[model samples]
Target: TLAPSAAPAASASPAPSTTASPAPTQATDPAAAAAAPPASVVAQYTALTCAPSDVRRSAASTDKAQDWIAACDRDGTTKYLLMPASVVGTDVKTASAGLQGGGGTTSINTGQWVVNVEFTGSGQGKFTRLTEQTIGKQVAIVLDGVVQSAPQTNERIAGTAQISGSFNQSDAEDLSNVLRYGALPLAFERSQAESISPTLGRDSLHGGLLAGGIGLLLVIAYSFLYYRAMGIVVVASLVVSGGIIYASVVLLGSAIGFTLTLAGIAGLIVSIGVTADSFVVYFERIKDEVQAGRTVRVAADRAWPAARRTMLAADTVSFLAAAVLYVLSIGSVRGFAFTLGLSTLSDVLIMFIFTRPLVALLVRRRLFSVSRFSGLSPKMIGGRAAAVPVATTRARLAKRPTPAGQKRES
Candidate 1:
């Protein structure tokens, strides 16, 4: 049957143009899990089905099936790498053709959960043929060797194919994300591996969080010591940023099944320096204007243009690098990139919502501008000094220049 040739997903990026398959990082969604089968339960099943063992394929497991096969799910259960036995070892011609996302939606009204897939001309034709041959057979829809869905074809699917099973909204979305893009592994081979764990041990998690806490404290202390009163704003902004990050982490964990790992913690800790740098950029700009004799408020106003641009430029670079890293790297590395990118965004938010506004308020206060501990004082910033006058020399010194045209003194 000519079906969508299951080829390796694009490892570099989540194609913006279409729902191309991605080696996506999946987290469990509570709502979806509650509505459907617990994702963990589903994962365990995939692991066993795809995992390789000493036993060879029998009537149930085809002879061509190898011991080692990876599935398409990112939820950490990869037992069988379903490359559409029909499309295995074959090339899929990717096109700008009629293929597009169905804007899929999940429905449970029929008593069975279903995710309706959208396809174009070639896809529709191939899907129809596939359904015909695989009648009463399960066909695996996999991404990056992880299976997203394996549906039994009951009849010749003429118009559209709906993956019906333990799918909830989140599960449907995950499957849709892969199908919308395209995750087809053209070839399947045997490779040995034990199993995959989605999280680190408790001890590892504690150690990572402890290390990150220490780093953040050190940064806060440094900010206080150097910037004085202004440092309060710095620290406050950071605390607020931390709160936001924490909330997001928790929310995302619940929504998408994301869990914090040691690598992700490290990414957050590293972002401390990056966030702190934003404070310095703004503060230093204020100092420069103060040194030039501008009032603190005026300095703040003037400094914003330059400081905002600089901070944005630097943060943009960090965010882009993190995004690239997230796309290219998997597992822990991708986790790190995810956190780093998240923190970069938080840094931007804190700057606008907290830091800048607080700074504006502080600069308006008399004590803030002139306090000894304040980083904004003219003396502290090395204010511009007035020029000193020089006295003219005596007539005796002027007489020495009279012989310029005469013979040299011996």
Candidate 2:
């Protein structure tokens, strides 16, 4: 009963087609999409090359907090500079990265790969404000005519930060050293850069890593030999410590631009001993307590308080030394200080939170102390088993040679 008029009407009606609709649905404004950053700004700088970590402030006794000035360059051209004055001191603290300049400044014979700078005291507040003000704005960090970092701040930065990009050892060190001496009066005369082969640097890095690896292995082996069963706890603590440190490094890199250098690796290597030293101290305390007639479990529990004190004392000193070094030094030295401090913190965490608890748990197992293979034996630890002395054994050791000639008649 299909009518001709009904068939035509059905054909004219809109159909869900295999393709998209003819008319555009909710058209987006081209300008709006372009208004905000489409992708992350940090990622953009990930491949940046020769970028300087120098953050400039205005000149001395100037009225404006930030000022723009034109200065002469070696190429006989003018370049703009944005230098901010120091808020607290006469001179703003910049990294001493070791640059080539005369006037009491020693030339760095070797190039530095990376330099890290942090804002301390009121500088922290100033840096936070600068990042906030520059949000969504292109802020160019330049050294001479070279653009170091030109990124748009996405959010308000409340803490210190690291400048990122591809930087050679010389460029970074030169920039850091320049910043340390305060902004150039006008412009820097560009000098011919002496090219250094990356191969040499790579070789040095390989050597440093090999040494660190060997040291770590030795420490682990020594712990096993001396501490016996408890060495397992020490190894576990070290593993946990390393994991935490790695996590911290990654997080810091993403969050604040912290970079690990060869010096930083050395700092980490040094921490292996520091971390193991804590275990040795704790285990020795426990053994002493065991020798005083205490059970393995009881000794572990009682010795912890004293062990905790010693660990805290030693680690505190280390942390303090690292802090002072960070404050007083610049460039890669600061990186070393930072890693050292971070490792100390990790050591404390492993010792109290993980190591102590793990030992306590292990000792609680009934078979742990009873098994001769466990090495928690009273004889092994020289404990008070009321051990009787052997006359034969004592006599041999106690008997001294009668004098050179008299002793010949053995």
Best by TM-score: 2
Candidate 1 structure quality by residue, lDDT tens digits, 203-307? 788898899889888987888788888878877888899999999999999999998888999999889989999999998998888777777789899999999
Per model, how many backbone clashes are there? 31, 7
What is candidate 1's TM-score against the reference? 0.48
Can you tell me which runs of candidate 2 are displaced by over 4 Å?
Answer: 1-194, 383-410
Q: In model 1, where do residues sit more than 4 Å from their true spots? A: 1-200, 383-410
lDDT of 1: 0.61
**What is each predicted model's overall lDDT from 0 to 1?**
0.61, 0.56
Clashing pairs in 2: 48-166, 56-84, 57-83, 57-84, 58-83, 58-84, 58-85
